[model samples]
Target: MENFTEVLSKINTAKVIAPQIDYSDYVALDLSIDNEELAQSNLQNAKEYELYIQRFLDRNKAKIAFGGYLETRNLYQRSTVFKNLNSEERNIHIGLDLWINQTASIHAALDGTIHSFQNNTALGDYGPTIILAHHLEGFTFYSLYGHLSVDSITNKNVGDVIKQGQQIGNLGLPPINGDYAPHLHFQIILNIESNFGDYPGVCNAGKLDFYSNNCPNPNILLKIDNNT
Candidate 1:
């Protein structure tokens, strides 16, 4: 059997969000801690994030702003879910985020069965999330879709069949989407262990090594090429 990373690299996937939009229309957006622009701007709430993304899209002349796998960010400061005095601040993002203001459709990246679904109601959590288990080339792995609208998990069940490019849900609005701008937090897990609908999408530097291996860059599956 091939290694998980090799298997993922060999697989191809459809656009996991808003399939109608062309890949060429996808522009990269930087919300990382190193981004001077994000540091300079005061993005207070979900509504502000919406406006910020809109401006970014308009300025870039692109339909969507995407990126942020393994990128460190300061945006999580507002929520205790990411930080507390006792815990190492989880500031690094482990999943790729596809951003757009509208409630765009979310799709399955590959053929799989629903592994789990949940509405993590914490202030800065995944909100509505879904995990899919897939087998390819004799390797079993999982895919997670987060920041989805409430309706997404409304009637989902474990082990339900999901097809490649199938519409699974819609991008959630702010507050419902962990109070951030609308986006789909997509991740690939080589070993899900006992994690259900939720997994650590963000981690601190100390835990980066393990997470970097367990959760490979989603682009390996997205085939987005150098995190375009």
Candidate 2:
């Protein structure tokens, strides 16, 4: 069997969001430790961090603020879900984020069936998340859409067929979307394990190798130009 990464390399029709966004409109955002701007700002709050992202997009004249795969973020410190005495802090982001306006439509990256849907309402967690099960070229994988509006999972059911580019839901606002900015946390899961509607989008430093292998880079399917 081909590895998940190799299978993704052959895919040419993965659209994680609306197709109207052109390559020129995408701005690669840096929230990692390398970004000096974020290091100086107080990004503990979701709203405040959201404003920073907005300012960046506006300043760059771009519509989307993207990137953040395996980025070490300090913002997760605000939520106990990520940091606790029982375990090490989980700050490494394992997905690609698309920072756009609130209520923007989210589409299926590929043809798949709804595996699970739930409103994972916790501080700094995935709100109204959906997981899609897909099979291509004898490979089975899953796609996770997080930080979605409440209405997104209202009528959804398990095993529901979803076509590529089909409207899955819209991006949720703060508080509803785990108290963060309106953005879609899109991740590709090679193995979902026992997780239901929610999966770990962030991992601790120690588990980087395990999570990195389980969650392949979403850009392999989206094909978005990180250089842009």
- Candidate with best lDDT: 1
Report how far residue 97 has shifted in candidate 2, in Å: 0.7
Candidate 2's residue-wise lDDT over 142-190, tens digit each? 9999999999998888999999999999889989999998899999998
Q: Candidate 1's residue-wise lDDT over 19-65, tens digit each?
A: 88888888988898788887788787888888888999999898888
Each prediction's total of clashing residue pairs, residues at least 3 apart in sequence or on different chains, is 0, 0
Cα displacement (angstroms), candidate 1, residue 55, comes to 0.9
Q: Please, what is the whole-model Cα lDDT of each candidate in the order they appear?
A: 0.90, 0.89
Q: Which stretches of candidate 1 lie over 4 Å from their true place?
A: 226-228
Instruction: Please give the range of 10 consecutive residues that has the lowest summed lDDT in model 2.
Output: 10-19
TM-score for each of the candidates: 0.96, 0.96
Q: Write down the worst ten-residue block by lDDT for model 1.
A: 219-228
How many clashes (backbone atoms < 3 Å, residues ≥3 apart in a chain or on different chains) does model 1 have? 0
Question: Could you tell me the TM-score of candidate 1?
Answer: 0.96
